[model samples]
Target: MNVTLRQLRAFVALVRTGSFTAASRHLHVTQSALSGLIKELEHGLDVQLVERSTRRVQLSEIGEAFYPWAAKMLEDLDSALRAIADIKELQTGVVRIAAPQLMACTLLPDMVTAFTRQHGAIKVRLVDCAVEEVLDSVQRGEVDFGIGPERALTAETTARPLFDLPFVAIFPPDHPLARLNRVTWKDALAYPMISLRGEYTRRLSADLQAVHPELMLEPVHEVAFMTTAISMVKAGQGITTALPYGLSIIEQGQLEARVLDGPRISRRFHIFARKNRVLSPAAAGFCDFLVQACLKQDWVRLPEAVSR
Candidate 1:
């Protein structure tokens, strides 16, 4: 009814050592204290648990039956505590993250690789979906957190700025835009643009309208993934726009990227998580590692106005 772990431990220790002096020594407590704990346990259970004498001690009928259960309970509790300690130390656990396909392919893989190298036992599970799906994944509790450009926050989600980066123009080496020392939105818009469809294009258009009302991104082709846009650019179909983090993909596609200027617009990326839920130790550690990793990269800059 009112049994305590201390009482249970004393009972088990006495049974194991078979003597009051040895049990108290093992528990680092005085013999009287150990005797009191055993008495308390038996009193709470309303049963005699120990047959005590001057030379030896042994379990009564009920004590023998309860000893195994108490020992097993303590063993299980110890194992659980050890597991939590391992997670806190980042020695073992899994971190689930969701991001846009481009970032999943370009930025996240390298970051995850670096993190795993440092925390060899932790596993990072990355979910790569469409740009619009990043927030959806977070809202649905499918991931520990989601990373992408800022979006309209829902009531169930919270956003924290990760980094802010200006857009860059991606074009083939031989393209006319590639020759320009400084490419502006106007210059890039002059050509047929290949843009990501859905919220990405909508947001870019809105941002452009806020800066230069007359300039708009009317892409010749609209696709779901940045990889597709890069493929189109590689085929000389059209130039595309991306953040600086996508430089690896651009380079791999045999395309060059120039920073966009002339009313330069930048997008802020954020880490999105469920509003009321707490992140696991592994997830929180991975998030911190990601922030530090971004800070080290020249391409990723935390705006002075933004704070964690």
Candidate 2:
């Protein structure tokens, strides 16, 4: 009852050293202070913990029983503190992130590789899901955070701006549109277009219609994943539009990307997380690193507000 760590330490030090002077030296406290602590501990416990003598000290029956318990408590606390220190220093921890499958395959892999190389002990786990499911993973507590294009956010979630990149037209290297330095929406739409299904195409169409009503994204095919669209483009099925961040996949597909102008429609990407939840040190650190990585890319135009 009302026992303090200093009192327990003093009792343990006295038992281990077998003398008041030695215990005081071990604790870097004066002999009188050490004696006072020991007295306080015994008084609080209502037991004579130490048999004090002029030249030696010994633990009483109750002290002998409590020594192991107190020592264990201190040892466990120290171990926990060390573990926290390791996490804070980025020496060891896990950062769980979710993203659209295309980003998980293209942009996130490179960024994760760079981050892990710098912080060798920290592990980054990326969950690849549908573009629409990125925020669902975050809300369900499946990931520490998520990266995806801006969407209607719910009150249970928070979004931090990551990148605002202009849409680019992607086609095979030999395609006629590849000749242009920059392709317009009309130019890209001239060919059979393959667009992503659901919210993505809807948002792009809405943005386009807002500026140029006559120009619409009437795609010949609507696919779920960007890779599928890119694959189709590579095979000469049709051309597609995507943000510049997917250039890696486009290049790997033996395709080319050109900036799409004529209203210059852009999409904003954000880091999504559960509202009012505190991110771990590793998660927060990786989020900052990701923002810096995006900043380094010339094509990525970040918003005025940074990550929360």
lDDT of 2 by residue, 1-308 (tens): 88998998888788788889999999999999999998998899899888775346877888899889988887898899999999999888999999999899989999999999989999999999899999999999999999999989999999999988878888887899877765788888889999999999999999999999998889999999999998898788999988877777654438777778897877889999998799998999999999999999756653211111
Structural similarity to truth (TM-score) of each candidate: 0.94, 0.94
RMSD of each: 3.5, 4.0
- Count steric clashes of candidate 1: 0
**Candidate 2 lDDT score at position 24:** 96
User: In terms of TM-score, how similar is model 1 to the real structure?
Assistant: 0.94
Give all candidates' CA lDDT scores. 0.88, 0.87
Q: What is candidate 2's TM-score against the reference?
A: 0.94
Residue 197's C-alpha lDDT in candidate 1? 88
